[model samples]
Target chain A: MPERVARRTWPVHAVLVVGALVMVAPLVWEFLTSVKSFGESVRVPPTILPGTWDWSNYTKVFHSIPFGEQLLNTVLMTAGRTAGQLLLCSMAAYAFARLAFPGRDVIFMLFLSVLMVPSQLFLIPQYQIMQELGWLNSLQALIVPGVFSAFGTFLLRQFFLSLPKDLEEAAGLDGANPLRIYWHIMLPLARPGLVALGILTVLWSWNDLMWPLVVNNDPEQMTLSAGLATLKGEHFTDYPVLMAGSLLATLPVIVVFIVMQRRVLEGIAFTGSKG
Target chain B: MSNRWWKVLAAATVVVSAAACGGGGSGSDGGPVTLTYAIWDKDQQPAMEKIAQEYTKAHPNVTVKVQLTANKEYWTKLQTAVTGGSAPDVFWMNGPRIGLYAAQGVLQPLDEQISAAGADTAAYPKSLVDLYTFEGKKYGLPKDYDTIGLWYNKTLFDAAGVKHPDATWTWDDLKAAAAKLTDPAKGQYGIAAPADSQANYYNTIFQAGGTVISDDGKKSGFGDPATIEGLKFWVDLIKAGSSPTVQQMSDTEPTQLFSSGKVAMYYGGSWEANGFAKNADLTGKVDVAPLPKGKKQAVVIHGLANVAYAKSKNPEEAADFAVFASGKQAQRIQAEAGAVISAYQGTQDTWVKAHPQFNLQAFIDQVPNSVPLPRSKNTSAWTKHAEDLLLKAWTGEKDVADAAKELAKAVDEELGKEK
Candidate 1:
């Protein structure tokens, strides 16, 4: 029986290899183009490999914009937003799932309704609020509005509902209050949901383009994505320099993903089946 | 508990509305001022910064901050900021948007400022000055100008044994040369005929003695017989197998194909000279000439202008900077940078001398017979609709005459609703 199963596995392995190549082709192309001259990059019947590996494009990216300052802004903004969402979303999800409040059902329904509207509808109104608070072109404007999100709350709520009620009931019978029960019993078991939310929030905050571009005007107060966008021109764009800047910007995110690959896959798969 | 939730929501709404009404005005006219200058070109940032420095040298109490945004998102960002009443002090404006912004009351008229400074408005081209004037008020001062020309690959022309395009070349002469230059075995076509307005069809329509819109900006000229003849010039080339198919041109940019040596002739603007000069593959292999004439000789001329905001905190300084930026001294500085042709009367010779490899004078020679870019109060509303309808005729899905008539009626309806 083992030999028969092994004989049929070759074709499946071949198909998987092809799918993997399709996913990795664009990254490989971007790296290749980053090292090429501008003329060779746009040549018809494009060359697969660079004839000359030029490194000046990387240095040009730094001279054109303040890459170091923008990278630091991006990191701080992502960390603040990710940490805020994890703590706030877990508490709100715990309340909606376990507590019996006066308007629990209606309030939860209202939270779900926010997920249906497009995010662009809130841009002007949010800008006005930031202006009123004198927070325009500041890091708080990028972080404060993004801290509260409906999707994160909804995802955490589903995970909380799947937890057994007996554990919380036993804690309640032990003379523990509702806050203590939530802190000691419920959160520890919802580890996968928290990890999943943290990963999604980090990815979204790192690559958010339109908001940063609109709210901030100073180069010192921008993110990596918005700073890299300034490399594009009105009539002509230097593709090699643009690709080089983007590749440099993407390295840290790729490294973080690689370090958390196992837990990320498990956390995502676990939520997929449970929800 | 439900009553308490309602009370909290009501209190939040009241706080938000009150805060919105409180933050309207900013800064007062006093000791020192820093005006924000917004532009969209990355390549020209250094020249812009130098100009800002020059302005600061003349006026010690004011400092100008140069802000750069890519062209793709500049309009969207400007509109949102303007709606929130936090727009920049002075910014770059174009011909297509002057009417819209002026009509919306966001742009400040520079007529009073220009005369007070003793600057000569006649130093710039009449066409560009006329382009920025809307409803008898000047909203922008012309900064630079560009015209379209016929750029062809000299290597292909030398190999095909055909004469290069010159001023005497007529429409028949262009057709004959195109037929001789096409080589199927080399996977090469003679020209590219994309449905582009500025570079391809707009020049031909004017050359064929037709207008895009009436001078009064009240009607569409697409229904005229001469305009249909202009449209047929490109459709005929595609049908004759001398140009690439519409599908092929859409897959890859026509400009890219021309630079790659797959097409012999391309209709491009004066801006193309800067890019082609930098391209290594196109070095010493391309040159430009005046566009071929049909019933008349004409080309579409357009440029960018500097405009001041109406509600700025320091309106006097902003208007002063706008006028100073368009003067001959600043225009000379821009021309010496070799990026654009300055609109000042005597400053164009430096731009022409900047690129010696190509015949850059062809762009300057046709300025006398140039037409200002066709614009209305809201040009974008109908421009997109016209491009979509013209594609059907270019792709051979419908007759050119029928498409033109349908497009004319639709554009007229859009113009009627503009006011």
Candidate 2:
């Protein structure tokens, strides 16, 4: 049995290695291009390696925009969205899952209906709401609309429904309120679900381009994704500078993934099974 | 739960009312007014900032804050901002979009402001002036103009023992030079004739004595025999092995091919002057000349314009600043910075002198015969169809005449909707 398993592992490892290379090649090429000169970068049948190591491309990114401020804005936006979604979605999910209420199923259906509609349909109305609130070009404009996601509520509701009901009933018999049961019993048990949601939110917010570009116009107020976009010119873009900016912007995300990859993978696997 | 919901609703109403009240009472007279001027090109930001500073120096109470967005996202953000009633006080407008915006009444007409300031519109190119006029009202002030030219590789010409492109070159002369300059074994082409409308075919179409859209703006002119002849110019180059295949050109853009020294000549715009000058490989090897003539000496002229938003809080100030930014002094400042070819006539002399290696005057000389870029209320709608149909002709998948006729029918249908 051990020999048969060992024979099967070789082909699987071969396929996995090929898949890993295919995914990693573009990032490697981007790094290589970032170090190349403008002439070398655009050469037909492109050269694989830089002729000279030019570190100035990194410095040029800083000169082009306020990279430090953009990094801070991206971090803050992600944190705010993640925290707001976790608290709000969990509470709404608990209400729909445990507490008995009139029209509970209908309210849950209304929340799920939002997930059915495309996000593009919401852009104009959301812009008007932000304009009315006088939040255009502000960090709150980037954070507030993104905080209340119907998808997150749906995901957490599925998670809450899967938990055993015996503990909740025992807590009720002890005279504990629904909110207390939710905070003490349900949330601790839903750690894997919360982590999965948190990871997904971080990935989405970190890579989001359209909403940040639409809401914020000021360089100082823009997130990294929006700031990096300004490096592209109308007629012709300097590819080296753009690639360099993209590398710096993605470094933090890559670092976090590498450090906590096991937890992220487990969370994803757990969500996949439960879902 | 019911009480909490009510409390939340009340809080939201109070917040909304407070915001509404706070936004209404600002931008009154005698108070400091900051007018936002939005632009797209990061390369030209310093020059724009300098213009803003000069305007602010003259008007102490009025400050112009410049905002920069990437070109790809500029129109998208502008559309959203306009719909949300938060567009910039003044923003950059282009010829293709001016008709749509002006027709929609989002752009402020500058006729009254021009007369009040006594600014001379004739100082700018007449074609550019006509471009921004809608229903006999001027909606934009021409900021900078760009005309197409033949940018040649001097090194390639020298190596091939061919004389450089000159003011007197014709269609046959360009073809002959291209054949001599091409060396396929080295993976080199003489020129890169991609399916780029503004830089390539549009100029040739006019040079061949054809129009894209009629003066009435109600019909398509792509079916004209002369326009087909104009398009055939590039196709013939590819057939003669002097230019890359359309697929190859699409894979590696003509700009990249030209900049990397793989192409001997390219039909490019005057706006590329700054970019080519900064390129390490192109700086010494490149120069410009008049676009080789066909049946007529014609080039397509397009430009940027500064237009005030009709819904701007400070409409008067925004219109005045828009005029001031495109005036002779500001244009000269822009020219001196090599940001663009200023639209103000005679100020181009400084621009010509800014970079002496290239014959920049070739672009200015074409202005006399320059045709305004063909546009209508719905230019993008027809132009997108034109691009699709032209690509088929360019790739040789369809006959040029057949493609041209099909494109004309589609464009006519789109134009019919505008009425």
Candidate 3:
């Protein structure tokens, strides 16, 4: 019986190992390509391992743009956006979850429809609004547009509805107001929801390029992803330099992912909820 | 209390945000007045920074921030920036986009400033200067001009026992050389005959006595026999195996191949000579000559221009910088560096000597036959469509003649919509 079970599990282990390797191979290849000289990178049949690594590629990334500043700008903007969405969306979600109001569903529907509509349709009009606000080339422009996320509100609301009512009722009986119950009782139960929302929001904000490129032109104002765009032009050569720049720009986000892997994986696990 | 929420949010947002969107510079306790100087070229960043430093030399009161956006996004971003009132005080403008921006009344016309500076428009090639004009007013000043030519690897010619390209070479002569020099066993090819635009195919269309669009910017003439003939020269090379397969050449840039000494001939812009010279492999080996003749010897003269934003608070300062940028002092610096053939006419000789090994004079000599690069009210939209269709032909998915007609029809339809 033990031998038969072992035979069955071995194939599954092999399959998972193969899958993991396939997923990681591109990153390994990108790192390897970043260090190769431009000429060697494109030679026929391609090199699996670079014979020599060029350290100048790291220096070249800084020359390409203000890499250190861009990384910091991206981090600050991303953290602010993620935290803002988590707070604001939870408030909106609470209003919808436990409170009663007329036309609530209709307002929720309107917000929800934004997620369905293609983002390109909103870009032009939103840009005009930013112009009017005189917030162009500002981090506020990157952070403001997606602050009150419908997806976050909807996700948090579902989580709120799914929570047990006993604690909130007990808190209410203890003479705590609804706001106090919400802060002290319901919010603690919504930890997983906030974690999920925060992870998605941060990833979205960090990787976003198009809107940032539209709003922010100065290197100091640009996020890492948008700043990486300067490496490409009407005519783009120097693919190694480009790849090196890209890898360097992406490293911070990758580091974030590593530090938050457990929560990120859990967030990804629940991504099918909207379906 | 409800109305006060907006004020509260505004204050909170201001407090939370790290990136400032301040418009004006410091006064007493305040920050300096900010000015955005935008451009689209990353290759020219060092030069732009030097120029920005020069501008800051005269005006320490204003801080000129250098901004860059990539090609398609530059225009898209500029459109947004202008509409948003956050456009750069000074920004780079391509020839075709000049009309679109000017028509929208977003660009600050520099006609008065040009005259004030006593700058001679005659010093610029007329074809290029004409692009910056709208309703007898010029919106841009030429910063540089790049003319395309036949760039060949001399070591490859020597190895293949072929004569060097000269003014005397004709279309038939080019074919003979390509045929002899091509050696398939070694991954060596004779020509980089990829069907392309701006750099590759446009030259042939002009050489064959065919115009891309009419002088009045009406219908596309790509369906003309001469234009089709010009395109066929490329198709024929691939069919004869003188050029690499489209698959083999797709991701590999031709200039790279020439500099690597992998290809015998490459048609490239004079702007690329610096890039070629920088490559250690081809330093003394690569050379330039006049493009092979079809009906008449013609080349395309193209460049970028710097323009000022109309929304700028310091319009006079911005205008002064734009005009000063196109002046001979700046032009001379650009010329001696060999980064570009500066728009100032007399400064080109210095540019030629900068790359001593290459026959750099050939590019300068072709200047007279050079015409304005094809431009329209919305050129990229039409040009991009043509590229996608031609790419189909290039991969041998569509017949060249059939694709040519389809391209011409699309251009005609696009032009009609513009009308």
Tell me each candidate's TM-score.
0.94, 0.94, 0.91
Interface quality of candidate 2 as DockQ = 0.39
Off by over 4 Å in 2: A1-7, A271-275, B1-25
First chain of candidate 1, TM-score: 0.96
Clashing residue pairs, backbone N/CA/C < 3 A, model 2: none
- Mark the regions of model 3 whose C-alpha exceeds 4 Å error after superposition: A42-45, A273-275, B1-21, B26-34, B58-63, B259-261
CA lDDT, candidate 2, residue A1: 57
DockQ for the candidates, in order = 0.30, 0.39, 0.47
Candidate 1, chain B, TM-score (2 decimals)? 0.92
- Writing each residue's lDDT as its tens digit, candidate 1 over B1-419 gives 33553464464344334322222233445567788889998877888888999999988778888888899989988988888877788899998898889998898999999999898889989989999988889899998898999999999999999999998888898888888989989978899989999888889999999878888788999999999888889988988999999999988888888899999999999988888888899998999999999999989999999999998888898998999889888898888877788998999999998899999999999999898888888999989878999999999998988998999998898889888
Q: Lowest-scoring 10 consecutive residues by lDDT in candidate 1 chain A?
A: A266-275
Superposition error at A9 for model 3 (Å): 3.1
lDDT of 3 at B367: 86
For model 3, the docking class works out as acceptable
